[model samples]
Target: MDITCDFNTLPKNGHYKPLLEKEELKTQLLLNIRSCLSYLFPNGTFHGNEYRIGNLQGSKGKSLRVELTGNKAGLWNDFATGEGGDIIDLWAAAHRKDVKAEFHEVMASIGEWLGYYRQHKVNEAESTISWDYLDENGEAIVKVYRYDTALGKRYLPFDVKKSSYTAPEVRPLYNIPGIIKADKVIIVEGEKCAESLIKQGITATTAMSGANAPIDKTDWSPLKGKHIIIWPDNDEPGKQYAEKVAKKLIDLGVISLATVKIPQDKPIAWDAADCIQEGTNPLEFITNRKSPYHNNNSSNKLKKIDTSIWTNTAPERKWIIKDWLPVGSVTAVYGDGGVGKSLLAQQLMTAAAIGKSWLGIDIEQIKTYGVFCEDDEEELWRRQCTINAFYQLDMQSPAFLDNICLSSRVGENNLLMVFDNKGIGQLTPYFQELLADIELFQPKLVILDTAADLFGGNENDRSHVRQFIQNCCGHIAKTIKGAVLLCAHPSDSGIIRKTGTGGSTAWNNSVRSRWYLSKPDRADASDIDRVLCRKKSNYSASEQNQISFYWQNGAFVECNAHFNSERIVRNNYNKKLDLERGRRHDVILELIASEAYKGKVYTTAQFAKYFEGKLGLGSERSIRERISHLATIGHIKFFKRSPEHELSNTRSKYGYLCVEDMELKISEDQYVFIKPSCYLSATNGVLMPVENPNVWVTHNFIINDNFKLAE
Candidate 1:
């Protein structure tokens, strides 16, 4: 049976010591398994490592699911619940208790049970020895001992019986008095070596967890200012542990330190105890083999600045999509549904599949790959046909078709299995196979159609989001030396802040570039006009802020990039402005204000009658929309007169008001306009409402400089 290395591999020559011998720990911890069969599973049977405790709770009456397998090592595996670990881990899972909370109690119980069993075995027939660890005042702190059994060797406390096995929480030096008074101390790997060295009038000690324990786990202050010698085991782990311990000692302000490498031909774990038994003079060897400590590991040294390598000008960066996607980096393209995110990606892919310019940027027909989790192969193929028809090229020709590969139905495929739901990500074998297939293609740019479909985790969770990026997309991009464009949707995108994309900041922060695509309102243009706003760019010196495209010639063309749709609306409105319409709107508002000033209420029809033949709009739909637009701005208010009518009854008459005139109680509804603040010029040269008949407080906050608010 093989034993796990607790700290590092043990050394020879009586120079190294550790807490428990691996053989001993294995006998006590692994071989002598605790039998709780009758208690946990009534009328159940136990045979060797396989204990058939019937089926689990919900899975009762099925195959014997509640079976434990002592996996030869000091651990058990649960095939039913997919859990495996030490005895304590099994105990926690079996009883559905918090593992962390039950750790201390579990350890204590295991220790006690093992002690009892070891005592029983020893009483039958065994040989053992016990030693007492004393404090500085000569009081006994702990009793350490070892015993041999049929399984092998075991170690435990002397007072093991009905009382719980009390292990010291704060491990003191084996010989506290000798260690405190001695100016020069030798630190070994375990207690046995310390005890052996002490018997030879040498002050020596070892940490509680021996070489396995981290530096923070020990109270290293006791060794301060003492000249120390660390003698490690003659193995790989021992040498590494020696280096670590030396570093910790140096960090803890050791006055001086050195190490001794003992040459040995014995097998691993043959330590100081074996050396003494073999009659080797370890004290002489320690003196002869001592050498100054050298922390040769580069990781142990503080990071130093390297100013020798300098550049006078910025190095040129390779581009996948001229100011947007860069090679060997990550970029995100996000938008609301049907704003041409997929279509735009298809167009770009088509450009890369053939040697063509995209958005005026030329490409050399590099390899292109697309993974659309939301779309199936048929839909993706249809999109391919669209791309071919739009470009008027036989893209299905062997050359271009061979260069581009499109994968769909990804959610159905086993790809999502790679990115686990938990934050701790691990790539699966299936995923590696997929990556291998992608490697065969060697695509320069990979497009993840939608993040939500590709990532099988809570997008809102920062850990999960970062895990998906770092362990999935980021890993692929870095591994393949290519660019990755992740597609996502915004939360009420056009109306909400571009940063509010329904996830943690890591979604945006982790990517190097991001973009937003939105359709322009039909009132200002046609339904096919889309504005691609560059939301973020880290690599570009000058960002392509907004790229507008029309769905003309069957594809996205950058003939006229719309910088600001709201600004265009304003300019068009100004060019078509008529004094009659402005005067009529003013008169309607003034009339409402005049009536409200006299505490009199007016209706929409009454206001429309006054503006009849005085404005271009002829129907009530146009007239009401004007009033709603006015009310949408802070200029007017439309509501029901009282909450009593609204709260007590659904059937109630709605009212209107000129806000500055009187305290007209009302509630806002669809009748109220929802316009974003944009200004326009009136004959009076004061800023007036642009009256966008179709504006929401969306991407339209730019105010006109020539127009001031109505005082």
Candidate 2:
């Protein structure tokens, strides 16, 4: 390392003054000089160290004589007022004659030290008359310069007075708002907190240091006659400061002091500056709170309080039809048992997680969280297979399902997840805590499968269920600001599909959208499976045949063909097959005609008998085959029974519709004819309807006595 020293010229203070102790302090000066030499060489003795009085002609102070002896000795000398220039020449001559190099260096060092001491001592002593650098608080720092009698000069040995200085001016200690006119002072411990108060238009100040700063009457006099609020730091020191300041204010006749405690685990702080930066208003934090510390002293104080005061504004609701619920929406999917409710929910969860379509509905990318409260090994296996099929990976491996959370945490949003298998009430805190975790991670979508499993109370009670749903929805919306999909089970009556697992209307009312699904007829083998579009929506419910799909190889697949052989066999004798074959639109028209005539409609078997029995077919299969054919060709009509019909079995009725009910305006030249299977298809055993009847009628048909043949 290299070491070098340079110096700047000294600054001029008020005036220069000489000390009166030049001659009288000669002994003291001599001892101090001897001590400096001794410090340089601990084992050396002073050969000559003396103070001479009035040795200089123009200077008022005396000079010092110094010598050093460690392993060698050095001569001592003092220069007279005019000898500074002469001493240099004398020293050079003396070195040439007898002065050793090491001895000369030592003398030179002593000479520099004496020069610095005299200059600094004189400057410092003279400038101290007023102690102008210190404030009213009496804290001041001063540099010292001693008077130099030799050479009549002041010189610095080392530049110790570099950049160390503090000015005595008052800086605003508290940030006060310009709006507040009250002459009050609120003392705080932190400048940031004081600024926070200032944002509320409150004038407050903080101790430049902490509350421990030594403040006297002068420091405390600003609020002598004004109001004082002591909002201190949270810990013991702040409380102590409050007490101390309060006592002083009391003595000064200013006793209107209020103590406001901001409850916090760490240090309590309140003010405008700190909180305004956090995007909060200080006045709101003050006026918007109901004191948790309120006492029960009076009836007014004990009045009923609404608990929602401290709650933040609820997240805005999102109403989703075909799309994902908006960042804070609560959505529910519900159906009766075996209605694929869980499957549908889980599908949405995985789709959100992977950014895929759910039931062919387009979706934007988002993380999804799903939890299944009811999962058997089979269901789990099925779910895993579905995920694998959808992702087209090895579902057996843990990685495929890893993104899907089966445990409580359920990786962040739009990622597939599930929750506890047991009831919800038992895990309220656990759910709330999970919501907190969601806020931390910020997933895109959250799905809770089967609302019933999550709730522990009586699901039939609409009010209670609504409250629970609202609570869960509120947290999810507020924290995640993301969509929430809830899986639910419909009621036992099956009146509505979206009745949740809790079996309450509240579930459907709270949800934004609802979709229903059910099995359709199979005897009319040409018809597809049905998905009922029951509730309110902007779009039409998918055709029953179009929406019903199967979960195959881990993904939802649209079925090309549906086989309802059981239904076909069970109602083979009834004309229910006509509606199944897609003639229900005409059937409804037929019912209107029949009800208009007699205020009552016949069952499906009656219509089937009317159409086929007129042709004298003994087998019900033959009549059904004909009805199915006619219905498919849009020549005849069919209708399913309404629940109000007095059927022995609760099953809906099916029937043939009259020609008037068909609602057609035919021209005089057009006529419809029924043809045997041989005319339409060789493979089909049933008959079919044809638009032209002239050719078919010429082939065969006998005019009956009861029914006239139109010519």
Candidate 3:
């Protein structure tokens, strides 16, 4: 939201002119033009080489076009209003500000969008400081630079070896050389805090990213045998960081570890820098406040639960989808490949985002995030269009886009956890970045598509699978106080058993709820019909364990028979028979019509042969029976035609014809037979077809006592 920039150090005549003229900056902006435009106009969509939207007012239309590729990238035009400019000008218009009058502010906003602070060139001596992180051989590997600007302090890591502003995945600690020779090293939150202690002849160091540094990514081997002391700032995050560092150090086999707890009366965020600024002795301060940390895992003590607290009222359970996904837990939906699992998951998140129904099940509407490893951005975009149509929602609405966040990692390293050299599962930097993003967005539901791509460990290893789910995915779910719906592919046995689970049973046991999406098992079922079976549910009833759906409009829609177990069981046999008969009728009618159109006719036997093993219509005998039944019902007719070779004295052949193409007359004496279940009207003595012919009904009228049908 802050759009102002510091132009005090620049020439008054052309503030931010330098930034605008920088070719490198322009190139970077163009490289990420799609993301920039998305941030500026959340309602816009990328179409081909251009991003389209209504106008700068963020409306939903294609009148405004912003080039997303080639030399004309970042250029845009609004055809409806006859207005156009570069990306910066578009940003100004989006914010309803004058470009020329607010150039500095515009540059600042752009800089913020690009993930940086916009400050005009300043005197290096007055506004910046640099600290070099040396390797074991005392050579500079990376340098951490700090800049004091009008906005706030900014830190950037520069890779000395690569000569680039980008930092390495695993960065070295600050003052590594200073801590290598010393047996006792003091760790602080920031470089300034470390330097404050170092000035007092103490061996002090810190990680590159302060309290937010990745503990697993940072090298702590240099202090493997040294006595470590962590001086945390007077804040909760700082304390947590210190605890994390201490645990990592203990794992590294450190000689000892301790934490320096600030006094209760100390101001918030007080650190060693402030301590030294107050003229306090740094060494004395550490010695006085240090509390030794102990790894108490060796003790066999267990804490007992207090039952006295049970007298109080219990908290009610919450759910993302009632009885499907409980809050603050990990739920899994597994299926075979190409079973529309991804599309189903996407629709669920979209429903939550737009407050719509998914498969006729209402969901808790909230912010949602999706990490799709198999799908690309274009594929997701195409899917989104169909989903929008199904939900009758505008994809370009700000509320829709803001509530949903999506990422496509098709060909990227999407591993959230990987085995290190020691064969221990460790979180990758990418996972850390994901956690940061989720924390920032605070989404209530996170969907990770297809575990085949994201899970890096051995699927057969029960320990690895459990750890990945509970420790990694479960942590994320707990952090957001919501549920994580993970998509997975079933194994060979899993498919055979129709359980929608694979690998170790741990995969099924680890998640709180595991549902399997698969096609219907019935031989006469439609190909588009899918069944989501609840194989494991810790929080739901067993009666309604499955839901049937039919694929429609690129998403799944609930079938009419969903959750009707009693009715389904009662009419199972009749339903299958009726469905098979209907299928056979369709096949026979289609073949007859096509052959008639081609000036060719086939007998009932020939049609039966053609229908063999087709549409699962059963054997030749069953097919013939179906044809005979259709003829009996007046849906088909038998026709006699002479052969082409009249000289041979061949007898006339009979072939089937669609009844609609023929005209016939029937006398009043002809009787039209009806099903036995039909009821006779009491008022007019007219027979009426039963609504459900398969279900027998008791009628009061008795036309004849001898007219009886078997139940």
Candidate 4:
């Protein structure tokens, strides 16, 4: 807050007494009295016409109430402290100063805060001319002071009650008393023009700040039922001002409205002031050129479409990410908590900025802007570190910093659209600032992380959600000629249905593209595995569009990495099958060894039949195949034994035996063996050479040995 004022230009003596007595200035202060209270009590909340706060300490409570509207606009009272005052007195009290003791300093400080510069010299050419704004009682409300300097003419408002020079937040119309009495009123661009017309016995009024008046903040209710004629200066800005005022007046339900168009032949910016100076009656001139205004919505004609244009081939559609997010449209990325939506969005923005692929998906390389409302600067720094590592990029490199712009609005008021008292959605001032930044940056992609924070309306309301997406986000996308990716959390039902939508169906319907990131739902899926599905797409096929990613190196990598190779897949399957076979082999060998020890050995066919119902091991044929393979590898040995009899007559049958219980020999040409220093053991009846018993051999090896195998 820099004060652009020359303090030396002010009178040394206490000549400020007269300045404080200007009643018109008091009215201006009262008009914007709400803002004044808010400034003094930053923690306060507005309840209808009053701003409520805890106490003078600015705590969060409703003990102090400051009137914001009507005749009591500047009045304030503290119920607990039993203290009260007008807006000026409140300002002084907030600063811990007595109004009378430190009047000059307080007034100067207040003026500076309200965008006023206190420079008044006695020079005739640089003299300040002010016109008082009067209320319906003919009492002064505020005064607009105009100073003609060498550079240009500058105006500063003087608030009488505050004893300072500052404009009101909501300015009153000049000559309100005159407007209340007149049935037909003339609206001019500046107070000087209105005063010029008023001198000629004409009913005229103007909003403060001339052509740049805050049309939304100005009180226009005074002319609600009056017939109004807008007298615009002969210039482009003035014409636009006239159109804006006409629209507002129509919305205000005025009786009738018209515009007095200045002749093109007249010099630029010629107005009622010029007419008055030229000795011409401004009203007479305006009366000759005025025309009734019609609302644009009143047209009933339907626009005809030309099908002939369809003969030409349409241009190819543009995309920020192919088949996922189209250019100049809104895309929503929804996910459950901790699904890495924000991280994914950040990586996408970074990849787009640096002309790299994001999770194996090709992205358009362009300037990008990111608004991460949930993460603060420190958190973003940590995330960027990991993302940089994944991309093998230097964070400070020009390739990254030059093309990427990021903002963290954690713990900040990030609402872009808010519903007014009338339930109509209006873009907030902060939103305008964002648009301004986007216009300057001209980014090709904008990522607003998490919709719950930026959207200020009800999420369940379809209209509010639709308006927010199409108006706020869509407008930004259109302005930048790119894409706006809004990140959001999925609703409970959306999560259950795997649609990744939240609140109203409009969240899915309104966006041109919708993507969902969720943990893989398959039984064998890893915890780190995630699947990004295109739930909806308007310009591209989405039914089979999905990408699989695995969390690695602090960032998500396409599952198509080395882990997804065909060779790796085959090896993994083979390894699992081998483990299952080993377990079954151990079961068979232990059964055989136990049966032989009990002198009740069974034949291979009997063993196979016995295992048929014992294990979930497939069909009996499959079990025979496994048994034959094990025997072929010499893991099982067979012996002819005296078989049993059910009725005392028996025949000898071949019985199964564990190889560990039999002496074995192997030909040198048929088998290769490790050094004898490595001990041999029958692992599941398969002799495996264990170089050190402490380290078990995972693979089987055949060996020629004359000694009995160790159990």
Candidate 5:
């Protein structure tokens, strides 16, 4: 056997302590065997360096012979030697304390020595040094020994590789008189954390040296669900390193992970020694530390989003509300009147009824039966026919009709159509019922065609409308883990309005995504030639471009951009009103109050009725004129209906009032007239709802003189 790097490879007279003769021999023998076996059986099994020493073998027969294999091939010749041959000389040379040959070479060389004995008619004998050294196959098993240089004695195998194996050097620490069983396991970066924790009655272990130390796989198995608290250094790397280890514990099923954010201004705390020296109580820190997992759960609670509801007890992952549909979000799809918004909405509902993809968005289409409060069934069916013909979609596909739900075959929510369910109080129960059906369908998306029919009475009530939309969106997004695309009509001229139909900005305010469709110049060019502007978003990038869709007979096909108007409508109103630059900032509060009071009766007394406890203005006259000026700017509209005054049963209270144009106005009598509030301000005098405390006058115009107060 050729042993590698003996004492000769070390410095001759350095302070290095050389191995003893016996230890050297054992190390050489094992290294040679390992080196040879590793090369021969790279993938095949070979036990670790430790083994049991087996019996010595010698055979004497007429024609029996043995040869060397692997690295020991050059150790011996083909034939045995005797008498004049150099057999004795070579044997004496091979058995020297310093000489090393491969295990196979040594075996072959021994066989040659025996062959020499046979040629000379020497006697053969068999003896075993150890009883457990040989297997049934007569192969020699090696026994491993550790050299105790301190005592200069070889000890038996320690079985240190076991799960309970404590370092022999470090065992005395555990035997200390003051040692106590700690209620918590304090995991630290190094041995110092363990020592620091031990000082504080915490049983702890440093993950060896750093975060990357080797961990015993079996040792970690018992730690699952154990309370493991980690303290990282007050730096990015330390926090990241600690999180890495915590994740490993989590993967192995640890109870939870808590992080103690270290403030950077404090003295640097890299390891346990520093922490202890700085009087940092690692145990207390861990006990009081906020768990990242717990914080996440608590934050989710506020939005009524529960991740653990689906993660903890469920066999399969439960859908969280956030994953299904984000709270405070809106999603919309806009196209021309005849551009197939209804058809697409139906297809999406159908696809959601049977989990499938529409236009490449992965969604589980529920068995969605829409209520046709607006459209007739024939129109709906006609659209469906056109859709099927366009996409050549087979209705027989399992992805077509698994859990389909319908409210009305006419494609809408029927209850809302009849009852005008605009408030969350009224809509929640309805949505919950719909959600129950949606879950059965396991839909990933729902369709509410043209929001006008949905928020019937209070369509202009953005706050109320948004609350309802959020409830519906939240339920659908969470229960079925789906999305809701509410269809809405554009203004009469097809101009993009904040409120899609019924003109409530809240319609767009509550959706997560909003896609505005503009009329294509050439309708015949392609049904898909309309511009889709991503006017709002939370997840997707905000982009505006013309996306082409081709109405191939009846179905719409999305294609690569063939026509792009690349139009950017700068909302000057928004840009000018940004308070940061202070350009039109003075008007921000006015604009906000006007928007808040949108679509409501604005008589002086009614203003008090609407904003008594809310409007914090001192001068009522100024507030009224502010309303009048806002109306003049087209931000609001004032009306005087002939019989409008009696609608609220407060006849001629102010004789005329302002309301959002979209609001249905009822006239009571000829005396109760309905005209723009601007007409009242123009013909009679401005109605003052409040007064300004700090009034100013310019060279050209005086504040209170130019406009008189209305009676």
Candidate 6:
């Protein structure tokens, strides 16, 4: 840390300066001795930390060649007058207080300076708990926490004088020293939570910026492939922060992750600190047995699904260009790198923003947020203007321009991240604020340009794929109640296979809608060779699975083919998509749980037929596997119906309720007819069967044993 030139240091205004403890007084005085000299003598001159001229030696002019450079730095001599003294004597002499007769008084005045340092220490607003944000070696680069006084608790740094505290750089996480050694690392929101959890023998860490710092903004690379659980502050921002971190961590390829979303009933913004303050064990709150997200092949995990809470019908599919762009879902637009992913998305956004339809496809006329990692605002504007000119739309119209919000990272700060002020990985804070901005605008569509930049994860890793899909497409889209258009690259071979670049099959599987834009025979391509084919369309409401659009006049318009899927033999249905079956498995089980609680029963085929194309689930085998997968995951139990209510013995059904829901009374309706199998309820955390005749179970069926929020 470079020290600031202390040419204008100030002396303790005696009786007014707060007194600091001995060590603190020494440190404060040493911090800027030149400042103290300047304060003592309104007539002293300084060059750097040394004296340039002094009135004590009567060398008021810059004639002295004396420098203050001894171990005591206070010892200085003027070559012109050969006068020298310790720093204290110089201070006393400069004040001209008649030090010979009032030596004690002069000394007392200096002592008063030390006492000034103590002022704030005794002030009720000062907190005693000093938290250090340490590096891997346990050396603190910065210390920050809150001060307790009549001013209440205030978040502040250890001292602003140190560059460690005030430099506009992102510091490492608090308690980073222990993160590597701990088998399990729990990431919390603030320093206070980090401290509280550490005291309970739990290893925890958090970076600077509270909820504002994204996980990518810090040195998370240290914890790469480490199993960790993220516990967020019990608030909206905290939860959002957690979601962002979780996604990035997956990108980092962490071994496992489980999020302990503190129960909703707790106070808002409550954190580990609150739990510790209330004498509650913080670690006890972590709910799930840690497992890698998405591919946790754990044999006994039960997920409780409640479709009843979901809207009776999913939201109507919204389109910017009919089937090509669906609202309230994640759509993947992939093409050859530097092809037209960004251009296609931009044209669609411009059309949507201006209430104009693209390729004559009716649009919902909604706003769009375009996050372009590739181009700066100026570049985006240049392209926007070109398109605007081609469309002959008024670019000056605030109604037209304001309908589109463009956030470009270009110029000097193109890669310099303010969110990750230190620039470790600025994604978290960047996206966190970006999403908040989206919420404010509530745009119907958000175009994220290029996963190559947004996702720092290996495009091929399944875990990274799951995390990204769940967060960006799942959580972000749901939060804004809009659609997300993710622009990405396809592998060099993707032109032939029809999937996006490096991203795993999970990326293709998780999104509600997907498209692969490419050209036929790149070596001999003609103007009309480009094809924007729908690779996946779970948003089954889309009108077409594929379309061929010609790039003309700086925008896409109908060419030889449009508004048709059959024309492009290779379409969404034909594309071999490797979608993750786990998510859908949970959905199927949840729907069955909802029906079972209402005393409805169904076999594998029956359940499959009922929910084939609804709830974003698909395929008979995929649906059938939901039963075994739910039982394997432990959300529900697999059981056989008794002879009285016979379903095939080979096929088991889950009608069991989790004890957490705990509604066991045989109201004339709770169980219209008692199946012969006994029910297992997790009472007092012990799985026990009811011997009383009232509650009867036909046979063992999957039950949601781990039914609490994995939040």
Task: List lDDT for all candidates, in order.
Answer: 0.58, 0.43, 0.71, 0.71, 0.42, 0.58
lDDT of 2 by residue, 1-711 (tens): 111111122336533321212211322323354554344333433234332333322123344233433211233344553332122232333344322444334333334454534333333334322211122343332222333443442311111233222111232233322213456676777545665676566777664444764445124544544556666666778778776765555544342445556666333544335456678664454344463222100112124677766567774444322433444556665566665666666666666555566665666555556666666556766675666577565655443344445433223232211222222122133553565566665566777766655665666544455545655554576466666766666553332111122344445555555544444434443323434333322233433322545555545555332544575456656634433333333233333333423433444455444545342343544545544443333333333332333323324222323322111112332212112212222223233343453222211211221221111
lDDT of 6 at 277: 92
Q: Write the per-residue lDDT of candidate 1 for residues 473-586, one digit (tens) a residue.
A: 766776668898888887553224333244544576678888877764334557778767676678887734666677765577764335445656665555235323443444
How close to the true structure is residue 137 of candidate 2, measured as C-alpha lDDT? 41
Query: TM-score of each candidate?
Result: 0.41, 0.35, 0.46, 0.47, 0.34, 0.50
| TM-score sort, best first | 6, 4, 3, 1, 2, 5
lDDT of 6 at 426: 27
As a whole number from 0 to 100, the lDDT of residue 557 in candidate 5 is 57
Tens digits of per-residue lDDT for model 4 on 1-711?
Answer: 333323324545322223432233355467567667777888999899889999888899999998887657788899998999888788888889897877656666776565444443223355567799878888777877775644467666876555566666677898898898898888998988998889899999998887899899899999876678788888999989998887787566454566766666789999889978998776556543242222221111123456876856888899988888899899999999998999999999899999999988777679999999999999999999999999999988898998999999999899987764544555665776788787798899999987998898988665788778987898799888999999999876456435565665567669999888998655466788898977678899644557878898778998664666774475657645644554466456545544543344454566677778575566666566555554544455444322231212224232333333221113322211111112223344443333442221222443323233221
Q: Any runs in candidate 1 off by more than 4 Å, and if so which?
A: 1-314, 410-434, 493-500, 560-711
Lowest summed lDDT across 10 adjacent residues in model 6 is found at 412-421
Question: lDDT at 425 for candidate 3?
Answer: 58
Candidate 3 colliding pairs, count? 0
Compose the digit string of candidate 6's lDDT tens values, residues 1-711: 211212123233211122222223334455567667666554567777476664463446664423455445666666566766766556666667664666545555664665442333233334355677766877767766444534345354553336422322445777777887876788888877887788888898886767887555476776675667787887889878887877677556454567775665789888878878988766544543342223110111234555777986786656555665565668888888756778888888888887776755657678888888888777788788877876788788886767888888543222111112221222244554666788898788888886766775556554556556665445567676777888878764344333443334456656777777776433334655566767667646644655556676666765444444454445433332322333364355446534654555565566766777786776655555554444333344324443334443443333332311111223443332332232324332233334553342322333442433110
306: Cα error in model 5, Å: 9.6
**Candidate 3 per-residue C-alpha lDDT over 359-472 given as tens digits, one digit per residue, 9 for 90 to 100:** 888876799999999999999999988888888889888768889999999999898876544444555557767887998998999999978887889886656788789867
Per-residue error at 626 for model 5, in Å? 23
lDDT (10s digit) by residue, model 5, range 1-711? 232223333344331122322233332333354443233223323223221111011122212111223333213232333111122222333354122444334433443432322333211221111111122243323222333332233322122333221222221111122212332455666444555667776666544324544443213443444455566665666666676665565445433344456655556545656767778665444444342222200012212444655754645332212232332344766555775677666765654555555544565334454544456766776766666555455656664555554445345344331122323223323443555565666545566776666654465555556555654454455454545667777654224222222345555556666665554433133334443444445664323223445455665556443423222123334422331222121232233334433423445445534543242442455455554443333333333443333434445434434333333323321111123433333334444331321221112211332343243
Q: By lDDT, highest first, what's the ranking?
A: 3, 4, 6, 1, 2, 5
Q: Which residue pairs in model 3 clash with each other?
A: none
- Alpha carbon lDDT at 478, candidate 5: 49
The whole-model C-alpha lDDT of candidate 4 against the native structure comes to 0.71
After best superposition, candidate 2 residue 216: deviation in angstroms? Answer: 43
| Root mean square deviation (Cα) for candidate 6 | 17.7
Worst 10 residues of 3 by lDDT: 294-303
